[model samples]
Target: MKNTLLIIFVLFIAAQIIQTPRDNPLSDPQKEIQAPKEVHAVLKKACYDCHSNQVQYPWYANVAPVSWMISRHVDTARQWVNFSVWEDYTQEEKEKKLKEIFRAAYAAMPLSSYMAMHEKANITMEERKLIRDWTGVRK
Candidate 1:
């Protein structure tokens, strides 16, 4: 039992040394997607953390296992729709991303796990409507 506990402690400490890539690539503000203040606010609050180059890392994000998971999630989310580089996308890509944004906002955006920590990121009905309206996605 003592040896097992010691190993576990050592493993935890070692894991902390593993570096996780949490890059926020440079993005041009002028080229960013334009939206109303309300719409942008909602997106910034709910989606930016994972889907943009403006991720705000909370303290826990620096922790080993958690950092790894957060890095992977952010990477995947950015691959799908990175708002920071919105102007770089083609028209078809923009349309697809808009549809996806509307769908995610109405269905499962600001994922429950994220909301657990960032209560403000929880999208209300009004915010959902704003996102839908901005995306021009009808119910």
Candidate 2:
């Protein structure tokens, strides 16, 4: 039992040494998504952390294992739809992304896993509706 415990402790310490770079790239203010102030507020509070280049990392983002998860999730999210680079996408890409946002507005967004630690990122039903309305995309 002592040996097992020691091994676990060692592994935990070793995990901390693994670097997880999370530098947010600088984005032009003009390139960010344009929305009504209200809609933008909701998106800023709920979606920006993972979907934009302006991530406000949490305390746990500096820890191991979990930090890796957060970094990877943000990286993946940026690849899917980066609001900070909204104007960089082609017209068709923007339309497709808007459609995706419309669909994700229901429940898939802000991911439950993320909302678990970030209560503020939880989208209220009204906010969800507002986002859907802003997207102007039909179901």
Candidate 3:
């Protein structure tokens, strides 16, 4: 009886995973990154999962039961700051938003839940400094 129940549960989970969307909303070529490769990778790892249209979701994000939550999170994240649409923002506004987001990140505010799940997203002191320095230079 227990074995049968386990198989049913596994099948249910597999069914959910099959339905998660795999669309790429960032088809705009203008959304290209000019930043250093390391910086870009760091941003992708820490920010793109939620904030951009080109999310490289992990295996857990692909799993069915969590796909809904992940999709909602991605939608909200893009609303706050869409890197693909970033070129549309004024330089001043871009600098301001970067400063604001980085401040919140340093304080561990904007993505506490995300950091809890993806340990790599937890900004290191060096990474924080790099971000701050990059933003400051851009300004």
Q: How do all models score by TM-score?
A: 0.95, 0.96, 0.69
Model 2 stretches with alpha carbons more than 4 Å out: none
Which portions of model 3 miss their true places by more than 4 Å? 1-22, 62-64, 109-112, 137-139
Please report, in order, the local distance difference test score of every candidate based on alpha carbons.
0.91, 0.90, 0.73
Can you list the residue pairs that collide in candidate 1? none
Candidate 1: segments with Cα more than 4 A from true spot:
none
Better TM-score candidate (2, 3):
2
Minimum summed lDDT over a 10-residue window in model 1 is located at 26-35
Error of 1 at 82 (Å): 0.7
Model 3 per-residue lDDT tens digits across residues 5-99: 99999887777846656555745758554467776777777887787777877777766667767877888777877777778778887887788
> Better model by lDDT, 2 or 3?
2
lDDT score for candidate 1 against the true structure: 0.91
Q: Which residue pairs collide, candidate 3?
A: none
Q: What tens digits encode model 1's per-residue C-alpha lDDT throughout 1-139?
A: 9999999999989999997988889999976888899999988989999999999989998988999989998999999999899999999999999999999998888778888899988899988998898999998
